[model samples]
Every structure is written in C-alpha cells, then in structure tokens.
Target: AQLFFISNGLSVGFASIQTLTDKSTGLKKGIKGDLTTLRPTIMTAVPLILDRIQNAIESTINKSRFARIFFAIFFSQKKFWSYYGLDTPLINLIFCRKFKAALGGRVKIIACGGAPLSPETHQFIRNCFDLKLLQGYGLTETSASATIMSLDDTSVGFVGQPLDGIQIKLIDWEEGNYKVTDKPNPRGEIVIGGHNVTNGYYKNETLTKESYKEENGVKWFLTGDIGEMFPNGSLKIIDRKKDIIKLSTGEYISLAKIEAELKKCPFIANVCVYGDSSKEYVIAFIIPNASHLKSLADKLSKSGLSFKELCNDSEITAGVLQSIRQIAKHSKLHKVEIPNKIKLCSEEWLPENNLVTSALKLRRKNIQDFYQKDIHLMYGNEHKP
Candidate 1:
C-alpha cells in the first residue's frame, strides 16, 4: 500500500504500534495525540486494529451513563437515516464528532482487510465515524487485491464484488454440504482466476498443482474459503474448508466461523474452539479482554485479585462462560455449536509465543499443544446436551 501510494505521488507517513499506543508519548499531547498530529484523511488497517478501536470507543462511551444514553439515541437515528440512503449531519456533528476526533478528525476512509470484521463492529464504525469503512477480501497469492467494498455500499457482512479483471467462481464442497446450486444464494468454495493469481508455489509442484489449476486456458487458485453469492453479485465468506471439524454426533462445525462469532462478546479478546470426534460437544480456550476482565472481577466483588487469579476464579469463569453462551445463541449458533466448556487464560497468544501467526491468525496446532492439559480437563467432565 505504501509503495502504491508513493508510486502515485501521494505522501505517506508510517506509525508503529508503540507510537500510537504509548500513553506516555500520546497522552502528553492531549487526547487526540499523535493521530491528530498526523491528521490523515485516509487509513488502512487490519480487522484486529479496527476491533481495538471499536472496543476503546465503546469503553469510553460506557464510562458515563449520560454519554451511553446519548450515543445510543443518536446511533439509532443515524442508522435509520442511513438505511434510506441519507446522512444525519446533525447527529454526526453533535454526537460522533468527538469520537471521530480521536482518530484525527480528518479520516475520511478506512480500508480493512487481513481478517473478517464482525457485522456489529462494521456497523458501529460506519455509524460512529460517519465515514467509509470499506471491508476487503484477498489472500497473498492474489497479490493482495481481489474484492473491495464500494464506497456507496451500505450493506454489512458482504465483502462486495470482484475487482476489475478479477473473476470468481464457486465450486460445491460435497463433504461440507455447501453447494453452488443452493436456493436464494449459491454456496461453495471460492476459486479465483485472474491475472493477479500467482503462477505456482516456488519449488513445490505438488502443493501448487493441488491448489492451482488451469481450466479453459485460465489459471485459477482454489481459495479453500467457502462463500455465498448474493443476487446483486456480492460475495460473503461463510466458512473455511480447512477449519471444519466433525463431532461424535456427525455434525460438522466450522471453527473459524464460531470463533468469529464468539469474538463479538465483550469478555472475549481471542478464542480457539476445539471439537473432538469422540465427544458430542466442543470446548474453547479463551483469552479474556483485560479491561473487561477487571470489570467482571469488580462486578463479582472479587476485586484486588491478580490477573491470573481472576482467570481462575470459579465464579468469574462461570460468568464468562454464561456470557459466551449468550453471545453464541444471539449469533444463531446451533446448540451443539456452543462450546460446552471454556478455559480462560491471562496470557495472550502472540506471534512471539508461537501461539499465533504474525497476522494474528491462530496457530491451531501450537495452541492445542500449549493447552493440551486444559483441553483434557475440560473434556473429562463434558456432558452431551
């Protein structure tokens, strides 16, 4: 992105995470701080960064009862007008301007990629900032360009249509029961064929042949990502082929999908859902949001405990599990899809720890190995619903 901007004669500035989040440096200049100093009109970020911004804004708003009430009323009003293809400038000026100022007050666009942004966060950003928060979909093999949401698109959850010269096709996955012939919307594995697709993996002919193919003289890359096509030509990624696991009851669950949904819960910062074919239920390893965990501890009258102790408190664990179940139900997950047990941890999974990738994607095998004991203990007392 920086190269593209520079090639186009646009000036680009970079800021490290330390520069942005370091309280000593940022707070010294006032609330807006370095971002306000930059005053950037356009920004690009991953879903993780965007999620943090959303969480921070929510945390600030929730600190005051009147602020929460004011935000709720205006948010609804703005959302209502947005549905009719209208803008509430008054609401933006009065209610959202303060929130927008935290990001420099000049941010006109935010492009999000790397991971799927939850529908709730997507809408929250759009309404709160009153700016274009475009969600995009792509992989490194495609040179990081594929589908990007249009600025005029008001819908949430869909990644939008393909880019110019990019062609997409969906093939049925029989084992997963995703079909291109499904009613209302065609669902299947996404395959990309275009000039942007890579020729092959270097010195790995077997993997290259398995994932890449030529049909009708066009090279295609099988994404292994399940998608549903809308009547308007938009695409919504629904699952991942590699993330599907079957339970003892013969029901298949998409771990990626469930994790995405559960992350919407305020208590959860990150989670890994695990299913055993020998068991009828699933279990999860959760990394709790530190601020939210502290709040939870306060609510349970268990304040002053260390982070590790808070994680192990039986009441707190049970409370968090209840909250997770509530969020899963709200997300319309099946009964079996809701994890039967969860083990909360104070330690975050990071690339440095080898529990997650640099892109923040879970290194499933590493995470499982790291928490094998917790997994066993949770499953030992598992009961089928």
Candidate 2:
C-alpha cells in the first residue's frame, strides 16, 4: 500500500510504535498522534491492529461514567440511522468528533484486510467513526488486488465483488462438503483467474504445478480459501482448505474459523485451536488479554499476581476456558467444535518466535510443536491410532 501511494506521486508516512502508542498506558491509541505532524486522510490496517484499537477505545469508554453514558446514547442512534443509509452529522459532531480527533481528525477512509474482521468490531468502528470500514480480500499471490468493499456498500461480512478484469470462480471441495451448488449461496473453494494472478511461485515447480493452472489461455490460481457467494455477488471468505481437520468421529472442523470465533471472547487475545485426527475433541492454546485477565483475577481475589502467575492460576485458567466455551456455544459451534480444554500462555506469539506470520496469522504447525507438552497433557494419554 505504501509503495502504491508513493508510485502515484502521493506522500506516504509510516506510523511507528512511538507515534501510535499512549505513553501512559502503553496501549495503541489508533492513529492518535500529533496531528500537525501527519494528519492522514486515508489509512489501511490489518484486522489485528484495528481490533486492538477497538479494544483501547472501548476500555477508555468503560473507565468513565460520563463517557459511557454519552457513548451509549449516541452509538445506538448512529447505528439506527446507519441502517437506513443515513448519516447522523449531528451525532458525529457531538459525540464522535472527539473520537475521530484521536484518529488524526481527518481520516475519511479506513481499509482493513489480511484477516477477517469480526462483525462486532466491524460495526463498532463504523458506528464510532461514521465511515465505512472497507473490508477487502486478497493474498500476496494476487498482488493484493482481488476484491474490495465499495464506498457505498452498507452491508457487513462480505468482501465486495472482484475488481475490474479480475475473474473469480468457486470449485467444489468434496471432503469439506462445500459445493458450488449449495443452497441460497454457493460455497466452495475460490479460484482467481485474471491478469492479477501470478504465473507461479519462484523456483518451486512442484508447488507451482499444484497451485496454478491454465484454461482457455487465462492463468488461474487456486486460492486455498473457501468462500461463500452472496446473492448480490459479493464473496465472504469462510474457511481455509488447509485449516480443515477431520476428527476420529468423521466430523470436519475448520480450525481457522474456530480460532476466529474464539478470539471474539474479551479474555482471549489470541488463540490456536488444535485437533488431532485420531481424537474426538479440540483444545486451544491461548494468549490471554492481560488487562481483562487482570480484571478477572481481581474478581477471583487473585489480584497482585504477576501476569505469568495469573496464567498458571487454576482459577484464572478455568475462568478463561469457561469464557471460551461460552463464546464457542454462542457462536453456534458444534459440541465437538468447542475446545475441550485450554492452556494460557503468558508470552505472545510473534513473527520473531515463528509462531505466527508477519500478518499475525497463526502458524499452526509451529504453534502445535511449540506447545506439544501442554497439548499432550490436555489430551490425557489418548494413544494415537
């Protein structure tokens, strides 16, 4: 994105930790920085960064009685009007303007990609800023130019139709039981055929043969992502083909989907949901949200404990596991889909640790290897078949 702006003769400024963080709390304050230095009109971020900002904003609002009451009244009003394709300028000026100032006071466009943005966070951002948080979909192979939500798109959850000259199709994946012929909306593996599609991977013929194909003179890339097509032709990425694991009971679980849903729990900062094909249930390795966990610890009379100690505290672990189960159930996951146990980690999964990608996507195999012992304990000596 920075390169694109620079090539187009636009000035691009990078945000650093010093500029994005609040000195007092050490939490990201979004784009809140010295406006005189760089008041950006457009911004792009990954879902993880945006989620952190949302948490910071919510935490601040919760700390003050006045701010809480003020936001409650106006937030509902803005949400109501937004449903009718209306803008509440009065509400924006009165209630949201201050919040907008925290984002440099001039950001008119905010784009989020890299990972799925939760519906709750999506709505919260739009309602707070009175601007559409455009959700886009693409991968490094597509030059990050596949689909993007239009400015006028008021709906949520769907990444908009393909960009010009980009063609998208869905193919059936029998093992996952997703089909292009499925009910109200067709669901299947996404295939992109267009100029944007790369020819093949560099110096890797084996991977190239497996992932790339050509038909009728147009090269196509089989994007291992599973997507659902809305009646309006928008695509909602629903799962990753590689992330599906079949259990001993013959039930297939989308590990990425489960992790995404579980991350919505306020107590969970990040999670890796693991399943053994020979086992019937899944387990999760979680990085707890420190602030929220501290609050939980306080309630359990375990305050004054260090973060590491809190992670090991039986009561805290049980509390977080219960919250994860509640969120899983509320998300309507199957009984087997809900994690059977959880292990809390005091350390975060960072790219440097090889537990997650630069984009913050889970490196499942690496994470499982890193937590092998904990996972074994969670499963309790179930012999592999």
Candidate 3:
C-alpha cells in the first residue's frame, strides 16, 4: 500500500504495507520532519492528526503578525473563489512552497479515518495541500473500510456511499429517538451486511448474538454508529449509539456532537463533554491551546500567569469558557446543549497516558474517574441526582 499510516501501530494490519513511520511521538513530525525520508505519496491518518497538522501550519504563519493578517485576508476571499479552483495559484506561491519542502512535494492523497472530521478542518487541509483527502468509514467488526469517499470527492463531513460489496442500511434507534423520518435528511443506526462483515465472534456468543441480526439470509452487523443519509447518497456519521446519554430531564444528548462543536473554538486544543442520568446539565473538561491561550493572556496583560496558572485564573477561565460558548452559538446549539460547567486542564490527552485511545479518541470513563473530585464539586457534593 505505499501509505504513510499514523496510528498506535497495534490495531489494523498495516505494518506490512510500504509506509513512512514517524520516529518521534506525534503527527507534528508530519509537518516538521523531512518527507524526503520516505517520499510518501499517500497518507492515512485520523482526523485528530489532520487537525494537529492544520494547527501547526496556522501557528507557523501566525508567528509573523504581517503573515497572519495576510493569510486572514487571503483565505477570507479564497473561501469564495475556491469553488472555481482560483485559490490554488496564490496558495501555492505563498504557502505551498514551504509545506511542500517538508513533505518532499509528493503527497497526492491523504486518507482520514477513525474519527469525525469537521468540514471546516477538512477544507482547510484541502486548500493547503491542494490534494484529495479521502475519508473512510468502518468499524473493527466490518474488517476495515465499509465505505470510502471517492478520490474526486472534496466535500467534507460525508463519508460517501458504501463499498461495492458492502450493503448498508439504517434502522431507528428508540433510545436515541433518532429516525429516518425527522428532517432535511434521514438518520438512524447504520447496519452493515456483506461478505466482508464478520459472521460472529469466535467464542463470545452473547455479544455475537446481540450485535448481529439476520435479514433476508444476510447477517447484518449492528454498527452502533448513528448516521445521516443525504440526498446525494452520501453518509454522514452523527454520533455513536453508546455516546448518547439521557439527562435527568429526559433529554437525549450526544456527547460526541457537543465535543465536536466545542473543539471548533481556536482556543480549545481538546475537550470532552460529559453528562448522565444523574446530572441535570452537561459539563466539559477542556485542554486549552497553549499558544492561543498565551496570546490571549498577552493581549489581556495577564501573560505572567503562564499556561498552567492561567487555567486557574478566574478571568482567563471565564474568557476560555466564553470562547466555547461563542463557538457553540455559532454552531446553533441550544441553551441546554451548552455546557453548564467547565474545568480546564493543562495536560493534553495522549495514548501513552491512556487518556486517549490509539485512534486518539478520549477515554471518557477514565477521564471522568480521574476528575471525580472536580465533577463532584461542579454538581454540589450533596446533589447526587
């Protein structure tokens, strides 16, 4: 496969594929490392890594106030002219040269999988790299990719139709109250059936039975992934079935959706939104963008606090929370959807620390347990409901 795969390297059997492996710990090396090392033309990475690469590039340009403003104006118009492919020449002349040097100027395709990629970030990478970013969708039980975007697909958020042999369908999930009848698009639990789909678990009959269903002689796998089918025949993953929690008021909340919207704020590096039947409202644990926080502190004449101390400063804390609210507002989130409480943390979640999955997804239960004290404080010690 000539694909540069970035992952924990334990999951998925891509080790034998011809690929470039990062010697260091992060996706940042993709931007900082010499691409001449492998002369890679294709890359497969999680959306988190792609976001990190975008942030790194933006940060580098932000170092120069003039360059920052220059890009701000350029991209503002690029967003309009991009539809006609008029933005490429200027972008190549100004930014692509430096970026190309880092990657040996040979990258033609980047396949993103493992997590939901925001449309904005997807487009940013496309505009910057001037390459096709194919997004793939699947689960471990489905073998690998059940669906993949076409090489010509530049649209984001949608993972496109299923593979040739894969048969995909949606069924209503009562717990989530999601159905195909609800709106501009149809959404429900995605079910997959095909030769590529596993028949059953080796010895775990209970799980195998619960996860599979027979329909017209085909054993369909219940993917537990909620998705929306578009008029264009594309599929957009909405949230995981397990990630949806019902509040004490009986309102269903998708933690994944909330976290995705919160992460949209430039000041937020990472965030995990939590709520359960015991809680009346949502709460968030946030890891701030250190550089962005520092810039904010400098602008406010509070640079003395430092990134760690700034997390505890009342004013800085308030500012970060407000930025999150603004981002939520821009996303048209309901008042109930906005987090009622938020806790700031300085440490970034990493696979090494087990705070994140190999795919870079947050370990929600572990995070909640680790912040039990803070969570308790947020919902008063005596308020257990």
Instruction: Identify the leading candidate in terms of TM-score.
Output: 2
**Pairwise lDDT winner, candidates 1 and 3:** 1
lDDT of 2: 0.85
Q: How many backbone clashes does candidate 3 have?
A: 0
Better of 1 and 2 by lDDT: 1
Give model 2's clash tally: 0
In order, what lDDT does every prediction score?
A: 0.85, 0.85, 0.78
Worst 10-residue lDDT window, candidate 1? 17-26
Q: What are the clashing pairs of model 3? A: none
List the pairs of residues colliding in candidate 1.
none
Tens digits of lDDT, candidate 1, 177-238: 99999988999999999899998899999999999999888889999999999999899988
Poorly placed runs, candidate 3 (over 4 Å): 1-36, 62-65, 73-91, 102-104, 300-302, 383-385
Best by lDDT: 1
List, residue by residue over 222-299, the lDDT tens digit for candidate 2: 999999998888999999989999999998889988988887888877888999998999989888877899989999
Give the Å shift of residue 56 in candidate 1. 2.2
lDDT of 3: 0.78
Q: Write the per-residue lDDT of candidate 3 for residues 270-301, one digit (tens) a residue.
A: 88888857777888998887788888899889
